[model samples]
Target chain A: MPHATRIAFVGTPNCGKTTIFNTLTGLRQKVGNFPGVTVAPAVGRVTGTNTEAIDLPGIYSFAPKSPDEQLTVGVLSGMEQTIPRPDGIAFIIDGTNIEKGLFLFSYFAELGLPSIVVVTMIDEIKACGSTLDDIELEHILGVPVIPVVGNKGSGIEDVRLKLTDIKEFAVPNKLAEPEADIPARYTSVRNIAANVVASPVRDRRTEFLDKIFLHPIAGPTVFLAVMALFFQSIFTWATPLMDGIDSMFSLAQDGINTVVPDGIARSFLAKGIVAGVGSVLVFLPQILILNVFIVILEDCGYLARAAFLVDRAMGLFGLQGRSFIPLLGSFACAIPGIMSARIIPSEKDRMITMLIAPLMTCSARLPVYALLISAFIAPIYIGGFFSLQAMVLAGLYIAATLVGLLIALLLKKTMFRGAQTPFLIEFPPYRKPSLKNIAVSAWGRSREFLINAGTIILTLSVILWVLAEFPRANIPAEMQPLQAAQTQLEYSFAGRIGHTLQPAFAPIGFDWKMTVGVIGSFAAREVFVAVMGQLYAADVSENDVTLREALGANISLASALAVLAFYVFALQCISTIAVLRRETNSWKWPAFAFVYTFVLAYSASFAAYHITLFLGG
Target chain B: MNINELAVGKNALIERYRSNTVFSERLMELGLTPGTRITLVRRAPFSGPIEIAYGHLRLALRPAEGDGIYILPV
Candidate 1:
C-alpha cells in the first residue's frame, strides 16, 4: 500500500476484540463518526507502527439488523464513502468459541482482502483444560492464526508484525459460496474445529455461576443488588472526589478575588471561567466511577445477564433489557447515561431511553430538590423513621421516574410503533476482568464526555454570567452590600427578561425573581439554588437556613411545590441536550426532547400550583 | 417441537427453522443450522430470555426468537 495501511478489526460482541484493540493502540485512539451516519467507531494507530487500526462494532454475522450493523457491513464491503476500504482485515475471535468465530471468519475471508485471524481468550480456554492448535488451524483455513491473550499482551507483537506486513496475510480464494446455506458454512467450520481444537471441554465454572445468577428468584434479586451497588458506589464513592473538585474551584476563585480587582475581568475569571469549568468537571468523578462499573460489568460478561434478567420488565414499556443500564445510569447523570445508550443495538430502544433519561432525577437535581423540600414541606417525623420532608423528596423522584416511563410507553406506541427488533445476546463464559482494560475504557468514555459536553456547558455559563451582569444600575452609597448586589441583579438583562416572562410564568406561580432563577438554572439544574440565593441576596447554599427562611417568608408553599414539580420534569441541563445531539447525530430528536419536556414541566407545574391553591395550602 | 419446548438440561438436535427470514437466517448463521446439537441451559426469571448452549458457545435469545427454532429431542 502506498499510504498508511488501514486494518479493520472485526469480531462478534464480547469476543475480546476491544481488549485486543486497546492493547494494540495503547491510549492513541480517537472516536469519529462515519460519513452520513451517527455511529462513531474508534480508530487508533498501532503502537510503534505506521498501520492504523479501526475498531468496528462487533457483530455476529453480516446480517444488518440495526443501523450500526448496516454501517459495519457498509464499511467492510467498501460501500462507505468517507472511510476508505481497509487494505487488510484482522479477525479477532474468542478462543473459547472457536466454531462461531471461524464461522464469521469464513465470511470475512470471502471479502477477498488479505486477512489474519487472532484468537483471543486463550487463557480462558486453557483453564478449561483445552487448547487450540493455531498452526494446524492456520493450515486448514489457509490463513495465519495467532492465538494471543489480548489483555495480558501475549503474542501481541507477532500480531502487530503481521499487521504491518499486510502482503503476508493469506487471501482466501474459496470456501463457502455467496448463497451457500448456513449448514454448508458450519460444516466446513465444524470439520476445521475437529482437526485443530483438542479436548474441547465445557466451562463448568460458568455453568455453576449461571445457576445462581440466572435463577428464577435469585436472578432478579442479584440483579437488584448489583444495581443498588452500582448507584451506591458512584454516589457514595464519588462524593469526596466531587467535593475536592468543587473546593479547588472555590480556592481558585478566592485567589482571583485577592489578585484581580472587583471588575468585569474578575467576575469573568471567577464565575464565567472558573465556576463554569468547575461545574462541568465536578461531574467527572461520578462519570469516571459510573464508567468503571459499566466496563467491569461488561468485561466480566455479567452485563448480558443483567440484560436478560430485565428484558421482560423493560419490554412492557416498549424497550428491551439493554435500555435498563442506560436509564439506570441516568439516575446519576444524564450525560453519561445518554453516552451509554450506544451499547443498545436497537434504534428504537436507544432513542426512547435517551429521550427520557433527563427525567430520571440525576444527582444535579438533588440540591434543588433538597432546597425546595426544606423550604416548604414540614420536617415532622413520619412513623418515627421517615421525615415528611424526606418523603416528599422521594415522592418527587418517584413522580419524575413514573412520568419518564409513561412518556417512553407513549413514544413506543406513537413514534416508534412497529415490529420489535429481535434480542439475541451471546453469553461469553465468565472471565476475570482486567483492571487495565476497565481503566482504559473508563478513561476513554470520561474524555469523550468532557470534550463533547464540556464546551457547551462553558459557553452557556459565560452567557448566563453576561446576562446577569450587564445593564448595571448604580446603588445608593449607604445601601448594604447584599442589597446593592440584589439591586444590580434586578437591573440586569436576565432580570429584565424575567420581568418580560412574568406573564408566561404567572400561571405556574413564578414571580419575576423566581423566573430569573429558572432562567439561570438552564445552565444546570443545581444552579437554581445558587440563583435563588443570589436573587434574595443571601449567600445561598442548599444547607443555608438563612436562604431557606428567606424563601419560606417570601415564596408561598404552592409556588415552592410548583417549582419542584417544574424541576422534576424540565430538561434544564444544556449538557444533556448536547450529548443527545451528539449521540443521535441529528437535531430532530434533541429538539423534540427539549420541546416535549418543556411542555411537560409547564403543564405539570400549572396543575400543581392551581391544585395546591384549590386545596387552600 | 420448538427449542423453547425442550426441558432444561435436555439435549436436542435442530430440525429446522420455522420460517426462512432474516431473523431465522441470522440464527442459522450463529451455528444453529439443522442437525446441530443444542442443550437448554436455563431461563431467566419472570419469563425472560432463555440461555442455550451449542458447541462451546452459549447464547441468550428471547422466547419469541426461540420459538422460531424447531428442535428434535436426541
Candidate 2:
C-alpha cells in the first residue's frame, strides 16, 4: 500500500486558500492542534486519492513574527518534531495582486519542494478587466499554474489531477534564493508580473462604497445597526426552528417513556439523557444563525473595515486594532475567538485579547438570558418596531462590551503594561459572499456544538442527574407529585451542596435552587437552564413557560438581573480555561484568568442585586 | 518627514527606515524597501491607524509604527 501523499497549502491571508481546501476535502477535514502548541492545523484527506492536504495558517512570509506563524515555517522546514515535511505544496496566490503573491512565492520555490501554484480570485481579476496567462506564468515560474475561482469549484479538478502527478513535477535548475535582498526579490517579482499579468484599471466602485463604509461617523453607525439586526435575528429567526426541535425531542421523550417501563432505566433515559442534553441542544439554531451572519461578514470583506473603524477606540485601551476581529468572533463562542487571536502579531496583545474574550456575550448565554428576560421583563414594544426584550438583550451586549474594555484598560495599566503593537492589517476587496463558503462554515460550527452536547454535556447531565436523584429519599404518602419531586431534590447530594453554598451566593440573590443551577453550569454556562428544567421536573419542551413560571414565582427582578450580571462577568466554561492554558503554554495565566473573572462576577452580581433593589425593581 | 506626518492621498517615495527592530525588518520584507513608491490612502476616523498603499498591497499602520518610516513626498 502506498502511503498517503502529503500536500501543504500555503498563502497570504484572505486569498481563498481555506475555501479551496474545503472544496477538495469536503467533510474529510480534521482540525487538531499541531504537536506541542494549541494552534490548530486543518488536515483533510483528498477524496478518491492517496493525497492529504494540510491548511496552514494564513501568513505573509516565513520570517515568523508570531508563534502561530512560527508553526508554518517550522513544519515546512521539517524543524518541528511532530509535523512531517510535505511531498508537495499547493501555493495559493491572489489573482488580483500577483506581485505580493510572487514575492512570497519566491521563498517557497527556493525550498525545492514539488509544488504547484493555484491562483485564486480569477473572477475578481476579470471583473477589473485584467487577464492572467497561466501558460505564460507556468513558463516563467517552472511550476504548474492552475487559476481557480475557489469558491465556485472551478479548476478544482485540474488541481486534483496535478496533485496526483505532483511527484513527477519538474523543477528549474536555477531557483530563487531565499537570502536575496528585499528590493531585489521584489524587483524580480515585479518583472515576472509585468510579463504575464496585465495591469487593469483600478476600480472606482470600491472607493465610492468605502466612502460610506469607512466614513468616521457613518461607519460606526452602520456597524452598530448591522450588529443590532444580527442579535435581533438570533431571537426572532430561531424561534420557529427552536420550537420544531423542541417538539421533536419531546416526542422522542414520550416515545421512550411509553416503551421503557417505570424504573431507573426509564428515568435515566428520559430525564437524564433527553431532558438534560436536549435543553442545551435547542440553542443550536441560534448558534447556527449567529455563525451565518459572522461568516457573511467575513466572506464579504467587511470585517477588516470594521477593524479599521474601531482601531482608535481599541487604541485607547492599549490594544492593537487587529484585536477587533477576535473579540467580535467571541460573540459566537470564546474558543474560536481565542483561536482567532493567533492573528494578532504581538504575544502580549494576543494574551490580553484572550483573557477578555469571554466577557463578550456568547451564544451559550443566550438561553439563560432569554429565559430570565421573558420571565421578568414585560414584552412592551419600543418605538413600535423593537421589543423591550430585544432592547434589554442589546443593552446586555453593550454592558459586556463596556466591562470588557474597562478590564482591558486596567490590565494594560497594571499587569500587561507595554508599548502598543503596530496595527498592520490588509483590507481585501469586497466580493459577493459565496453561499458555499457560508454553508460549510455554518455546518462545521454546528457540528462542533453538537459534538460538545454529545460528549461533555451528556456526561455532566448523567452525573448531575445522579447527584440530584439518588440516596433513596422517602416521599410523604399524601404529597402531590410535584411536591414530592421537590422534596427528593432537596435531599439529594447536589441539593445539599447547594444548601451549603447558598450563603456565599445569597447576597447576590441566588436561592438554593438557583445555586444548584449555578454549580451545575460550571462545565458549560448553558447547562444552567437544563439543570433548572431537571430540578423543577418541568418537561424540557415546555421550558418556555414551565421553567419560566417556576423561576418567576421564586425570584424577584433583582435576582434575575444579578444572575444575568453573573454570567456576563463569570468565566464559567471549562473548555475556555483549558484552551487558555493550552494557548498560553502555562498554568499561571489561566489560573489568573479564572480568579479575576470569578471576583468580577461576584462583585458585579452583588452590586447589580443591590442596585436593582434600590431602584425599586 | 515620517509617515504619520504625510498627508492623506499624497504620493511619496520611501526614503529609509528609522527603526532597526524585528518589526521594521518584517515591514521591509513586505516590500516597504527604500525608494519604494507609496501613497497614504486615508487616516481612519478619530485618529485611528493610517492606511497606505504600496504597489498593489494596502496596509493599516498605527501612528507610532508609521513614525519609523521616513518618506519623501513625490
Interface RMSD (C-alpha) of each candidate? 1.5, 1.5
DockQ of 1: 0.77
Q: What is the C-alpha RMSD, rounded to one decimal, of candidate 1?
A: 3.9
Per-candidate TM-scores read 0.88, 0.96
Please identify model 1 stretches exceeding 4 Å from their true place.
A1-3, A165-168, A325-398, A414-421, A511-514, A520-564, A572-591, A607-617
Interface RMSD of 2: 1.5
**Distance from true location, Cα of A564 in model 1, Å:** 4.3
Return the top candidate by lDDT: 2
**Candidate 2 residue-wise lDDT at A44:** 89
lDDT (10s digit) by residue, model 1, range A1-617: 56888999988877889898988898889886566555778999999888999998887777776666776888999998888888888988889888888888778877888888899988887888888888888877788889999778899999999987788688864557787767998898888787787866778999999888988888889987886576556545776886798678778967997999987898777766776666557667877887788788888889878888878877888888778778877876798688767777677888899999998888677667756776787878879865676567667777998889899999999998877768777787888888778888888877865773366556666676787778878879898766766677778897899999899999999998899878877767766755564455322322324556788988988999889999999999877887788788888988999899999999999999999999998
Show pairs that collide, candidate 2: none
Off by over 4 Å in 2: A172-175, A476-478, A538-545
Cα deviation at A85, candidate 1, in Å, is 1.1
Superposed by TM-score, candidate 2 places the C-alpha of residue A138 at a distance from the truth, in angstroms, of 0.9
TM-score of chain B as predicted in candidate 2: 0.94
